[model samples]
Target: MAAKKSEYTCIKDNTIQNISRKTAELEARADYKDKRIDEINHNMEIMNNKLDQVLNSFNDLKLQSTSDDKELELRLKAIETKLAAQEKTTEDNKARSDRIIAIVSVILAALTFYFNYMH
Candidate 1:
C-alpha cells in the first residue's frame, strides 16, 4: 500500500503541473492578442490624421488655382479691348486721309483748266 500511494502522488503532481502550464500559455496568448489589437487601433488613428491634413492641403490648392484663373481671364479681356480700340483708331485715320487726297485732286484739276482756257 505505501508503494502504490507514492506512485499515485507522483502522477497527480505531474498532471497538476501540465494543467497549470497550459492555462498560463492560453492567458499569455490572450494578452498578446489584446496588445496587438491596441497597436493596430493606434496606427489607424495616426493614418486618419495624416489623410485629413492632405485633404485640407488639396482644398487650399484648388482655391488658389481658381483665383488665379479668374485673374488671368480679366487680364486677357483687358488686352482684347485695347486691341479693338487701336484697330478702330487706325480705320478712322485711313478714312480721313482719303478725304484729304480727294479734295486736293479737285483743286489741282480746276487750276489746270482755268489757266489753259481763260488765262
Candidate 2:
C-alpha cells in the first residue's frame, strides 16, 4: 500500500509540472500575438494618412481644373465678341464704298454726254 501511495504522489507531481510548462508557453504566445497586433495597427495608421494626402491632392487638382476652365471660357467669349464687331465694321465699310463708286460713275457719264453734244 505504501508503494502504491508513493507512485500516486509521483504521478501528481509530474502532472503539475506539465501544466505549469503549458501555461508558460501560452503566456509567451499571447505576448507575441499582442506585439503583432500593435504592429498591424501602426501600419494601418500610416496607410490612412497616405490616403488622406492623396484625397487632398485630388481635391486641389479638381478646383484648379475648374478655375482654368472658367478662364478659358471667358477668353473665348471675348474673342468671339471682337470677331463679331470686326465683321460688322467690314460690312459697313464695303457698303459705303459701293455707294461712292456709283455716284462717281454717274457724274462721269453726265460730263461725257454734255461735252459730246456741245462739240
Candidate 3:
C-alpha cells in the first residue's frame, strides 16, 4: 500500500510540472505574436503616410499640366490668326497686280490707235 501511494504522488507531480511548462510556452508564443502584430501595424501606418504624399504631389502636377495646356492653346490660336492675316495680304496683292496689268494694256491700245490715225 505504501509503494502504491508514492507512485501516485510522483505521477501527479509530473503532470503538474508538464502543465506549468506548457502554459509558460503558450504565454511566450502569445507575446511574440503580439510584438509582430505591432511591428506590422507600424509599417502599415508609414506606408499610408507615403501614399498620401504621393497623391498630393500628383495633384500638383495635374494642375500644372492643365495650365500648360491652356497656354499652348492660346499660342496656337495666335499663330492661326497671324497666318490668316498673311493669307489675306497675299490675296490683296494679287488683285492689285491684276488691275495694274489691265490698265497698262488699255493705255497701250490707245497709243497704237492714235499713231495709226496720225500716220
Candidate 4:
C-alpha cells in the first residue's frame, strides 16, 4: 500500500507539470496574436492617411481642370466675336468698291460719246 501511494503521487505531479507547460504555451500564443493585431492596426492607419492625401490631390486636379476649361471657352468666344466684326468690315468695303467702279465706267462712256458727236 505504501508503494502504490508513492506511484500515484508521481503520476499526479507529472500531470500538474504538463498542465503548467500548456498554460505557458497558451499565454505566449496570445501575446503573439496581440502583437500581430497591433501591427495590423498601425498599417491600416498609415494606409488611411495615404488614401486621404490621394483624394485631396484628385480634388485639386478636378478644380484646376474645370477652371482651365472655362478660360479656354471664354477665349474661344472672344475670338469668334472678333472674327465676326472683321468679316462684316470686309463685306462693307467690298460693296463700296463695286459702287465706285460702276460710277467711273458710266462717266467715261458719256465723255466718249459727247466728243465723237461734237467732232
Candidate 5:
C-alpha cells in the first residue's frame, strides 16, 4: 500500500509541472499578439494621414481648375466681342467704297457719250 501511494504522488507532481509550462507558453503567445495589434494600429494611422494629404491636394486642384476655366471664358468673350465689332466696321467700309465706285463709273459713261455725240 505505501508503494502505491508514492507512485500516485509522483504522477500528481508531473501533471502540475506540465500545467505550469503550458500556462507560460500561452502568456508568451498573448504578448506576441498584443505587439502585432499595436503595429497594425500604427500603420493604419500613417495611411490615414497620407490619404488626407492626397484628398487636400485634389481639392486644391479642383478649385484652381475652376478659376482657370472662368478666366478663359471671360477672355474668350472679350475676343468674340472685338471680332464682331471689327466685322461690322469692315462691312461699313465695303459699302461706302461700292457707292463711290458706282458714282465714278456713271460719270465716265456720261462724259464718253457727250464726246462721241459732239464729234
Candidate 6:
C-alpha cells in the first residue's frame, strides 16, 4: 500500500508540472499577441496622420485652383468689356463719317444746279 501511494504521488506531481508548463506557454502567447496589437495600433496612427496631411494638401490645392480660376474669369470678362467698348467707338466713328459725306454731296449738288440755271 505504501508503494502504491508513492506511485500515485509521483503521477500527480507530473500532471501538475504539465499543467504549469501549458499555462506558461499560454501566457507567453497572450503577451506576444498583445505586443502585436500595440504595434499595429501604432502603425495605424502613423498612417492616419499621413492621410490627414494628404487631405489637407488636396484641400489647399483645390482652393488655390478655385481662386486662380476666378481670377482668370475676371480677366476674361474685362477683356470682353474692352472689346465691346472698342467696337462701339468704331461704329460711332463710321456713322459720323457717313453723315459728313452726305452733307458734302448735297452741297455739291446744289452748287451745280445753281450754276447751270444761271448759265
Per-model TM values vs. the true structure: 0.66, 0.71, 0.73, 0.74, 0.77, 0.69
**Candidate 4 worst ten-residue window by lDDT:** 1-10
> What local distance difference test score does each model get?
0.92, 0.93, 0.93, 0.93, 0.93, 0.95
The sequence of per-residue lDDT tens digits that candidate 4 reaches over residues 1-119 is 46555343465887899999999999999999999999999999999999999999999999999999999999999999999999999999899899888898888888888798865
Give the poorly placed runs of model 1, Cα more than 4 Å off. 1-16, 101-119
TM-score of 6: 0.69
Model 3 stretches with alpha carbons more than 4 Å out: 1-11, 108-119
lDDT tens digits by residue: candidate 1, 1-119: 46555343464887899999999999999999999999999999999999999999999999999999999999999999999999999999999989989888888888888898879
lDDT at residue 40 of model 2 (Cα atoms): 99
Give one digit per residue, the lDDT tens place, for model 5 in 1-119: 46555343465887889999999999999999999999999999999999999999999999999999999999999999999999999999999999999999999988898899965
lDDT, model 6, position 32: 100
Candidate 6 regions exceeding 4 Å error are: 1-8, 100-119
Give the backbone clash total of model 2.
0
Angstrom error at residue 82, model 2: 1.0
Model 2, position 113: C-alpha lDDT score: 85
Q: Write the per-residue lDDT of candidate 6 for residues 1-119, one digit (tens) a residue.
A: 45554333464888899999999999999999999999999999999999999999999999999999999999999999999999999999999999999999999888898898965
> Which TM-score value belongs to model 3?
0.73
Give the better candidate number (4 or 5) by TM-score. Answer: 5
